[model samples]
Target: MKLSSIIFIWGMLLCSSLNLFAQQTDFKNFETRESTLDERWELTSESSQGTFVVVPYKPIYILPGRWSNRPNKLPTSLNPDNVAKIPNDYNNFEARFQLSIKTKITSGLLFGKGDIWLGFTQTANWQVFNEKLSRPFRELNYEPEVIFNYPLPSDASIFGLKPKMVGLALNHQSNGKSLPYSRSWNRVVFHAAFEYRDLSFTIRPWIRFSEKFDTDDNPQIGNYIGVGDATFVYTHKEQVFSLLVRSNMRLNNRFKGYADFTWSYPIKGNLKAILQVTHGYGETLIDYNYKQTTVGLGVSLIEWL
Candidate 1:
C-alpha cells in the first residue's frame, strides 16, 4: 500500500476518534489541573488576558560552539543564477542563536473561542571564530507568522490524549539575502495540540504556496525541508526534554526527513542550560538540502511547554 494512502486512513481514524471520545468524555466532575499548555497559550478564562503581552514562542538560546559535521560552503539552487560563484570560507564550528516571540493580536473570535496571534522567529549563524572571514554572519533566517487558535473543551480527549487546541496559521520564512543565496517560502499551516500527563505534542502540517519557476529559489525545498513536523515536549521537575521531527512523508526512495533533540535543565531563575543535537537537512535555509549532524551547547532563556 502507498504511504500517502496509509496516512490518509490514519488521519481519518484520528478524526473519528476525536469526535467519538470528545462526546463521551465527562466534564461535570472533572477539575482542571495546572497545565503548562494552558499557561503558554492562555487557553482558559483564567489564563487569557489583555492583548499585546509578549511571550516565548520557541526556545531562545545561544550556542557559542556549534559544530557541524559538514558545512555547505557553496550553496546551489536549481536556478542557475542563484548558484554561488565561489565557495565561502565557512568554518566547521560557528556560533548560533535564535530569538522567538509571540503576542496576542486580538481575542474573542468565533463567538469568543478563538484568538489571533502574531509571531516572529529569527535564527542566525555567525562565524565568530573565523577571524580570516572577518567574523561574518553566515546565514540568517526570519520567520513571521499569523496564527488563529481555538481552544478545545477543558476535558476533551482524543483516544487517551487530551486535546488542547486547534488552529491555522499563515507562515512565511526566508533567508534575507539576494541572488543565489536567497531562499523563501510561504505556507498555510494546520496545527493541533495534545497532552498526555507531563508530555505535550504539537503537530503542524503545511502546504506551500506556488511560485514562478524562474524566480523560485530552492525549487526542491519541499522535498528537503519537509511538508510537516511534530514536536514532543516532556517536563520533569526542573528538566525539560523535547524532540522535533520533520518529514516529507514519502515512502519511496525520495523520502527525506529531519530530527532535533534538545535537553534543558535549570541553571538559575528563568535561565537554563541547553544541549541540542540535530541530524538531517534544513538546519538553515542556506543548508536546506545539505544534510549534516550538529551538536550545540548553550544557555536558554525560554523553552517549549
Candidate 2:
C-alpha cells in the first residue's frame, strides 16, 4: 500500500469519472469564450434561434468569489498619503457578470476576413455578508469595448513576435462617478495573442485618450493599474490556471506590481471551483492605490472567458 500508488489510483478514477460525465454533457449550457467565438455559445431562455443571440455576452456564473483582503478598507479620498477610512466590512462575497448588447455585426461584412464583436464586462465588489450597512456594494467598474479579432496566419510575424490572433478595441473603463471619486479612462487597446500547446499568452497595450478636463481624476492611478497587462493561461483538460500581471513601465515599475492568479477545476457540468489570488492593487476602482493580498474560493461558470 504505497502512498504514491494509492494517489495514482485515485487520480485515474477521478479522470475516468470526469470523462464519463463530459461525454454525457449537453454542451448547450456550457459558456466559454472559445465556444462562443466558434459560434457555439450557450443558449438562454431568451435566446434567438441559430448562432446569433440578442444578448451576446455570455452569463458567467451565479457567484464569483468569497474573498479576504489584507488591507481591507481604503481611504475615502484618492490620496496616497491618506490612511484608510473606517465604516466598512471586509471578507465579503463577490459576484461578477459579463454581458453584451449585440449589434448583430461581424467580420462577414469585411469580406470574411475576421470576426468583429462588441462586448462589455462589468465587475462589482460587494460586501454581501456584512449587515453593518445593509450589505452595500462597494464599487462597480464598467468596461465596454468594440473588439475585432483577426485570425493571424501561421507564418505571420511582427517585430519578431508571432501572433496567433490580433485585435483592436476601443475600450472605456470607468467607475461612473460624478466628481470627487470619479475614475474613468478611455483607451484604444491593441492586443496580440499567442498560443503554444496548452499555454496561451495575450499582450495588451493601450493608448489612453486625452481628456479635456482641467484636472485629472486620480492622477496617479496609472502607477497602480498600469497602462497594459499581460495574461498567461494554462489549461490541462478540466483544470485551468491563469495569471495576469500589470506594472507601470514608465517609472521603471517602482510601484508595487499587480498580479492575479486563478486556478479552476471542474466541479459539475458548466460549473467549476475557482480559487483566485490577487496581490498588489487595483482590485477595485476606488482602491486603485491600496495594495493588498486576497485569496478567494467560489464557483465559476466560465474559466477561460
Candidate 3:
C-alpha cells in the first residue's frame, strides 16, 4: 500500500478511537493474569526504561511435520528434491520469532493514556527433513508494526459491547522474496478490546492501503488473510483458551476466512503448554493461496493477545 494512504487511514482511526475513548466505561470483572491475559493498561515504573519489547510475538516453537496439501516452494536453482517438484515433504518444521524493537517494555506516552511499542515478528516454514537439500527455507514472512494503545474506560459500551482498550497500528507484512512467490502488503489496524466477566474479546478491523498498480503481489490477499480478525480469549483459573477468526468483510461475491483454535496451560513462570489448530488459506504469505489444515503443539513463550 502507498505510504500516503497508510498515513491518512491511521489519522482517521486515531480520531475515532480518541472520541470513543471518552465514552467507554471501566471493566473490573476479571483480575488480569500473567500468562496470556496481561492487562492492556498495565504500565512500567518511571525508574525503569519503560519501552515495550517486540520480536517474539507468538511463543517460539518447533512443530515438526506441518503437513500441507501443496508441495513446498523452493528456488529452481536449489532443485534438491530431485523431482524438482512433488508433494511438499510432510516432515518439515514450523518456527517463528518476534524480535523486540522495544516491544516488551510498557511506559506511558502520547496523551499519557496510551503506550507505544514497536515489534517485528518473523514466521518461517522450513524443510528440515529433506537432508539431501540440507533443509532449506520454504518461506519466511516478516511483520513489523508500530502500535499505539489507549486504555478506554472499562465501564460502558459503544454498540452494546463493553470496551476495555483501543489500539491503532501501522503494519507492514511481506515475504522478502521475488516474483511468482513474492507477497507483501501494508495496513492501518484499529482494535477495540472488550470484556464481560471472564470472556474477553478483541475486534480488529483494518484497511489495506491503496497500492500502485503492478505492486500487489497477492491482489486478492484480503480474501485469504482476511479484512480483519477478532480474537476471543478466556481464562479459567490458570488455563487460557483462545479463538481467532479472520474473515473477509464479505462484500457479496468476495469472502474468505480462517480460524485458529488454541488451548494453553501454565507450565512454568511465563511458559505455557500450547496446542494450535488452523484451517484455511493465508497461513503464511507463500501459502496465501493454498488451503490447508495443520496442527502444532509446543511450549509457548507468549500468548496471542
Candidate 4:
C-alpha cells in the first residue's frame, strides 16, 4: 500500500474513534468549567455568542526585519514548467507579516455539541530592502479552511491530559501565482486539543488530496512540509511561549521536518513584543522544499490562547 493511503486510513480511523468516544462518554457529571481551548473555541454557553462574530484564528504579527540564513533563489519542482529559469533577486532580510481571522458559521450538531467555523490566514514576505531590483513582494500565501469542532466534556481526560476538543477541517493553501511561481494544495486535517495546567497542546495530522501529476506544483511537498504538526503553548504570568514541530515521519535516513520557537511578552494593553526563531523547510508555501534558518522580531496583536 502507498504511504499516502496508509496515512489517510489512519487519520480516518482516529477521527472515528474520537467521535465514538465523545458519543459514549457521560457528560452528566461533567462541569461547565472552561479551559483555554474551551474559551478559544467558545465551547461553553458562557463563551459562545451564536455565529457571525469575527475572532482571531492564529497569531497576527508584523516582522519588519525577518532575516534568513539562506533564501531560496532558484525554486525547482518536479514539473519542468514550474521550475524557475533565473535565480530570483531576493534579499536575505525581508519583512514578514501574517493576518488570520475566523468566524463561527453555525452551532448545535451531532448530539447538540458541534460548531462549524470559517477561517482565513494570509502570510506575506516583502522585499522592502531590495531596491536594486525594485522592491517587490517575495511571496504570499493564503490559507482558508472550514472546521467542524466537537467540544469534549469538561472532565474528559485522555492519557493523563485533559482532552478539550476534537475537530476536522478542510484546508486549502496557495501562493496565488502563475506558472513556475504558483503553488497550491488541499488537505483534510484532523485536530485534537489538550491541556495540562498552564500549558496547552494541539496535534494536527493531515492527509493531502492528490492532484493530477502533470499539474501538481510541488509533488514532493509532503516529504518536505510533513503530514502533521504539533504545537505546544505555555503561559507564564504576562509572557507566552510556544513551540511548533512538524515531521514527515520518514525513517532510514530520509527524514525531513521543521521546528520553530516563539516568545511573546506583553508590552502594553493587547500589544506584545514577539521574538521568533525557526529552522527547517516549509516556512512558506513557496519555500516548502527549501530549508533555512530564520530569526524574526516583531510586535503581535494576538496570539494562540
Residue-level error in angstroms, candidate 1, position 37: 1.4
TM-score of 3: 0.72
lDDT for model 2: 0.60
How far off is residue 259 in model 2, in Å? Answer: 0.8
In model 4, what is the error at residue 260, expressed in angstroms?
Answer: 1.6
lDDT of 1 by residue, 137-203 (tens): 8999999999999999998876779999999999999999999899998999999999998899999
Mark the 10 consecutive residues where model 2 has the least summed lDDT: 39-48
Model 4 agreement with the true structure over 110-211: per-residue lDDT tens digits: 999999999999998877677765667899999999999999998777677898899999999999999898899999999999899878999999999999
Stretches of model 1 off by over 4 angstroms after superposition: 1-34
Clashes of 3: 24
Error of 3 at 73 (Å): 4.8
User: Which structure is stronger by lDDT: 2 or 4?
Assistant: 4
Q: Could you tell me how far off, in angstroms, the CA of residue 300 lies in candidate 1 after the best superposition?
A: 0.2
- Model 2 per-residue lDDT tens digits across residues 272-305: 7877788887777777777877777766555544
Candidate 1 minimal-lDDT segment of 10 residues: 24-33
